[model samples]
Target: MSSSPKNAMLAEHRNIPYVAAGVTNPLQEFDLYVPERRNTLDTRPPPLICFVHGGAWRSEDKAEHAGLARRLAAHTNFPVAVSNYRLTTASTPIRHPAHAEDLLAFLHFLLTWSGPHTSTPTPPYDPTRLYLIGHSCSAHMLTSIFLQPLDPASDSASRSPTPSRSPSPPPSPVPTPDSLIPSPALLAATRAVIMSEGIYDIDGLLVTYPAYKTWFIAPTFGRLRSYAPWNTASYRSRPGAEHLNWLILHSKGIPW
Candidate 1:
């Protein structure tokens, strides 16, 4: 759905509160928006799009785009949700991977947002057709955590000195014809996604990006590598995964 439909599905002012990231108190609050409308399909079921804010994973909030969410819901004829995630602070307990892990929790919240699975007694999801949108830091979290693969084998001695969200998974030679294919805990079924101005290159960005170095890629999610190389090639080689219909508004396109 486009912006048009999103603006069509909101109340004069509808607000929903959610915890997009963080594991403890003062985690943060997120707001859901629906534009004020009359005789609009706002009441009807429609697609859903979720947005992640950017602040280099250090800070950001849903209010950053609450208006956009409402306008989007009204114009696109879809429901829009924005979320908050953990960030790096100047105080004690500085855990770097906290942001990435928070996203996973948020994703879980999205998947089971409605229906049988909700943190609350009720589900917040309105429909499928999930589209994720992120800018800058949020994009890094979204892509690195959800899309990009890690090298997995690198470690203390041979590990690439970089500020990676994670390390390469420990060395495990690609599965042979005799081995069983590793299964995915999550499916690559995202309808579409948008990322703006991000350090997509995990290796290059991590080595240079200051924020990542401070975050703990090593202590947290682990130096988890990406899908098997074979899997990436196959997934990309497939019809939709390659096309992805992804919109990368950046200084350049993807490598190769």
Candidate 2:
């Protein structure tokens, strides 16, 4: 006989293929682990913890994070989604915003579950209880999306007037629109963020790793310093850097 209903709840669907790929290319995708026992009829749907994998934005793929996604889902009893983004390399060197844009697209797909090749039906979600976690270069991309400036042209309600999305205790005041304009649904629902070994200050990084200016930074960001909005310093003078709850994770001697 089949397992009991409670035991059956621990199910997983892999390689659902969220985005469509061309004849010879791999489209961006995410792996979602849904808890089996969650109540679909509850007043509020379960919260989600989305993870962005890190590869310095130049190496690695989403499948590498399957273990993490599975573990988190099992331990927390929360649906966990792990995603992959394009990487920059010598042969096909992409720039700074490329990763950011790719990740934003992933977020769009997650919230709406309506991409051209989405596999599953839109799962009920507590929009206001969403949390995002990113590691390494992915952390930087997540930060850019979080700290992005609200466009004055769009409806004010769509974007939070308070710019900063950091989840901090209090006090300590601090801190751009672009190709990435977040959806209204996502803006209203996002709650907190966790960044692991994130690269925040770009200019500072260049200053610290002089050779990287030519080897890495230039290839990824180009010579135009002002165009680099990924830098955390760029947000300092802007309004609204205190809207979301934030947690930053770092290891000693990592030097990010």
Best by lDDT: 2
lDDT of 2 by residue, 1-256 (tens): 0111223544554444445444222436666677764555765668889988887677787668877887887888787877777677877766667778778877766775532224644574454568899887787777777665334345342222232243312211111346555666666567788999888766666666667655555565555333234555344322333467888999876665
Which residue window of length 10 is worst by lDDT in model 2? 167-176
Candidate 1 residues lying further than 4 Å off, grouped into runs, are 1-9, 12-28, 35-44, 115-127, 148-189, 202-244, 251-256
- Residue 195, candidate 1: Cα error in Å is 0.2
Model 2 alpha-carbon drift over 4 Å, by segment: 1-9, 17-27, 38-43, 114-120, 149-177, 223-229, 233-242
Model 1, position 179: C-alpha lDDT score: 21
